[model samples]
Target: MVAFHASALDGVARNPALPTPLLLRLLAFDGGGDGPPRYAPQRAGLPESAVAVILAHPNPGARVDFAMSKLAEPAQRARLVDDPSPKVRAALAYGPEWGDPRASVALPDDVCARLLDDPDPSVRTALLDSPHLAPSFVASLATHHDPAARQVAARAWEKLAPDERLALLTDPDPEVRRVAALGQCRRDAHLTAELLRDPQFAAEALRRGLLHRADAERHVAERTHLAALAENPSLPADLVERLAVDPDEGVRLAVSLRPELDETRRMAIDFTVGDLDRGDGVHWVREGLADPEVLRRAATSAHPLLRRSAARSPHLPPDLLHLLARVEDPVVENRLGIHHPDTPEEVLMRVYARLGGTFSAWMAETHPRFPREGLAARYADHPDGNYRRLAVRDPAATPTLIERLSHDPTVWTRQAAVGDPRLPLHRLREALHVPELASSAGANPALPEDEMAAVLNRAGVPA
Candidate 1:
């Protein structure tokens, strides 16, 4: 309302899981701002009333932003099918659940028919490569006029029948053949030997099951292919030993972290440990986590990233959690505190005490085991507002300290205080008028039912 601030809209967007109608009024007031629409507020699974607010609006930019986000239904998003803006139409081509890796949303059949032949070539291209598409849709693209579209069909080789796969693999387009080759190599092992000798495809070919002892011996020294060979789960054990001593420090480093190697054998190898922060979870780890043995192996891995990944499992047992606690990395300790229920109070304190728990304040309030006794007294007088904010976690916190923090200089700490039940009702009401504090204050469970409804009424919702 005050010069179209993004926070007014994004505060609702950032917590899409909340059953709230705030996004409706914010978008209604702003008309979705200038230029292209942002995606944050339009996430899939938002309440129908919130989604209707945007869908019922006439703003092309708002509709475009909505197209790029997850949707409540395929038909809901498909309403934008004949939109005038080419960009809006193109955004719809990305289909449902845009960035979600675990689930794909299938567009309604009627919508898919329209988008398949959209006037904009760019839209058609996006539809061709869109996630959540069925295999049959990809198979039908095998003979599309656009070679790029045909290339997308080729990548879906497993989904295609043998004859259909052969047609795309033999397509006249060189690039299409290349994109299809890696997948096809897995289907036909005999073809791998030929591809292995070709420099253009050798690295990919080396990772296949077709790579025998002779193949490993031959390509083991090819520096370009070492990383691929190192990644191959089926790589020969003797070859693993040979690569463990390879001249390339990168190869030796990779071999040292192989999950199959015992800690003693792995530590004995001379290798440079990679210092970059590797991110959480590998696909293989997720696939194999069902087996208790796999989880135990990954939890105790010499690779720090693998251990960090195992720490994310809610099912991780106590002994493994303790084993990870001994790991020297502070981030690993934070992962434990964030996920595992059995993570002890001292470990949580250790992580927050070291890292200030910058992005993970939820633990202080909701973690069942977080030490509540004396929490307020320990941190209420701390000079660092970040640490002082911990006082709000205790229900028995003195009213004087809660009042002081409700107006703390740091916004994060201030927001936390505004949501605490110990905060005076008058201060919580005051926060509802402050633009930056309104969303958190509105969501506070401590706020009375009628007062919460009144706050929503002010935001233009029916109380």
Candidate 2:
């Protein structure tokens, strides 16, 4: 009899109750009978029989694992290596005996096969991490109809032969296909080149290849593949278009920003921005939105993302805001800052109001080339109070308009009037006295104190 204690598990075993000799004999063997054993062993000094009873006891899982881990002998430990209970097997797997093939017990082939099929994924994960798992066994797992097993096989693929690795390239599962793609990228260069040339596989392969290779040969191959893929008319147009719109800003910038594009092709793709399939919608929205011809085409495109992209075109001339104003989509309409007669006065007013600060701030932060003064002046006299308010904030805002809006009943209108940079200091002082206009003075930091003061005076406040 002995008391067991270790630093690793802290003091969990310090006071464990020791099983009686009779109970220990029952646990150490499969054959058993009958009921409660009498007289448990004394709690402090545990006998070897007590340890055997603890390892084999059919009670809670935690207790079984704790006891098996405490066992130190080979024959006793081998007794559990293939225990029918996965919990018992797992406990053995986690034990120090796991690394010693000499201690390995022969697992039933059927049991190993069933474990390979376990619906629980972690069981298989444990299998792969085991030392020198047989390649034949792993090969069977790789082709397993179960997507999870195939994925596991795909990961530890260096052990697989080229053909065996290539077999998974068309796996039914997307994740499997992705993993197979990674494996394919490394082992078989010929297959990788084939994938890079196949339009269907080129995009996915290129995306994965970039992660694997970086030297000059790989770079040249990648460029040559992209340029060749770009010209393949038989390739799906949408995929090609995606290439044209590659999320890599560098790629998008390259196509649209290229100075070498012939005027004819550039203009042709520009005009096609609205052509349902040929519409260089992405590049058009990227570069052509400034041209009226381009905006009209983009405004009519059926694609929503393209339409949204078109709306963001900042290069549109001032006079074109009227045409863009007619776009039915609010997303595009808002981006164009249209103030047309058909546009609801409310929306027009919001657009105008946004121009001075909210609009300008967003533009400067996200899209730097937004032309501010010219656009604001175009709508200075808009009938909507919101538009009038925005006009007042523009650097181009006039004194006469400031004086008129200072008296306007709408608080927002009065605020805009008081914030006008064009208003004389006396007029701004006057406007500041009006209670409704007072708070409007400091609302926009962009509205200089001198301009706000001029608006305050115009509203009849003393400055």
Return the TM-score for each candidate structure. 0.68, 0.29
The lowest-lDDT stretch of 10 consecutive residues in candidate 1 is: 3-12
- All-Cα superposition RMSD per candidate: 5.9, 27.2
Report model 1's TM-score to 2 decimal places.
0.68
lDDT of all predictions: 0.67, 0.46
- Give the best candidate by TM-score: 1
Number of backbone collisions per candidate: 0, 24
Which candidate number maximizes lDDT? 1
Question: Tens digit of lDDT per residue, candidate 1, span 1-463?
Answer: 3411232233334444334544454455443245212543366565667666766556667777777666446667777788777777877887653333323566765676588778888788778767767666777777777787788788766677777778777889988877677667765565666678678888777764365667777677546678667756668888888888888887776676666678789778887544444465543565465567877988887776577677767677778888888886776776777777777787777766776645543452345667777878898878888777888887788767888988888887888887676778888778777877766666565666556445434433322
Q: What's the distance in Å from true for residue 230, model 2?
A: 27
